[model samples]
Target: MTGGRSPRRAVAAADRTRQPTEVRRRLIVEAAVPLIAERGSSSVGVRDVAGAAGVSVGTVTYHFGSVQEILSEAMVLQIERYYAALSETADRATSAAGALRLLVDALFTEDTDRHWRMWFEYWNAGEHHLDPAFAGGQDRRYESWHRQIRALAERGVADGEFTCADLDGFTTRFAALADGLALQRLRQAPPLTTQDARRHLHRFIETELGPGPHGVGLGPAE
Candidate 1:
């Protein structure tokens, strides 16, 4: 099954509707992410996802083989949406920093915010052993975020709008801050929105990379 066409490539909404295997497969996993998010992955089963997705238990087992398969698929399901949003926003971006801003905002959108919730749930549940899927997803996600931030810092330096003594160090610093901020917002719905996160980020960059290697002079500071 792993060697066969990946669900991602096979993911065709209209086409999925046309294929029973694809349709059941998609439903089973899509239903599983939230299940695992709300209930620990170990507690979630193929039957659970099938019931939630309104499909037969047999159908879920047929597509996923076991609870492990279902949970692993859920991991993929959670991150795929976030990456898709990032890619789409990046495509429309004119600047690297703008792309980074869009990436955070997209993840925090009211309807899409559950992925963040799901992430915390996964970690809290110690799900890696159960799912064994998307093993490097967190590292990959951080790398992508850091790459964008570094590019933005470089661009600011080039445009004389920002400065940074060490691009790599600053990127890591901000990525850590972004995560802490995301977690805070998730647990407590801070006064800060994703917009606030980006605004603070922009201000931080201005300080690190702006005039005299600091300060955006962005006028009446927030």
Candidate 2:
């Protein structure tokens, strides 16, 4: 063997050493998401995130000031992913009512259980730890969610698919109902099923929004 590294190997080494700081920071955040999901934010540490991200503890600290910061960033990333997917799926619906139906279906399904778990964990961490960043992020995220609901409701009203005059009131109540039902489903204290949550949401929609222009009733939940 030669005494020097090959050209390709040397380029690869250079690339690793020259990796962009922001990209490396994002990698650490991405890796920390699942860990936070699996083990709450209070339990995760810089070393654990470093191991998960396959980087040194110093590397993680170089990007974030503390484990709390890393977890906060990870929570923000997860929330973005969650809302992005929901928006994408809702966009595929042809009508406002259809979009609302699709959102309820997507939100209460077994597929979103992990996402709900992470969200609840993040909320708890923010409240118990008194993290201003986390609290502000949570408020911003919920406001976005409420805006999404308001937009859909406005579209429905404009299209003559719904007859609700109090859009703001409806949006607030709808969001609160969904959050309460989701918490019940997550805790299983009352043994709420996905189907139960979906049906409850749909019923609320029918009651508040008038079941669209076709008088569509809340049938069996899928």
Each prediction's TM-score versus the true structure = 0.70, 0.85
For candidate 1, give the lDDT of residue 108: 59
Q: Which stretches of candidate 2 lie over 4 Å from their true place?
A: 1-18, 128-134, 211-222
lDDT of each: 0.62, 0.80
lDDT of 2 by residue, 30-79 (tens): 88888777667777787778777767778888889888788888988998
Candidate with maximal lDDT: 2
- Least accurate 10 contiguous residues by lDDT in model 2: 1-10
Candidate 1, which segments miss by more than 4 Å at Cα? Answer: 1-18, 37-43, 122-127, 130-133, 189-199, 212-222
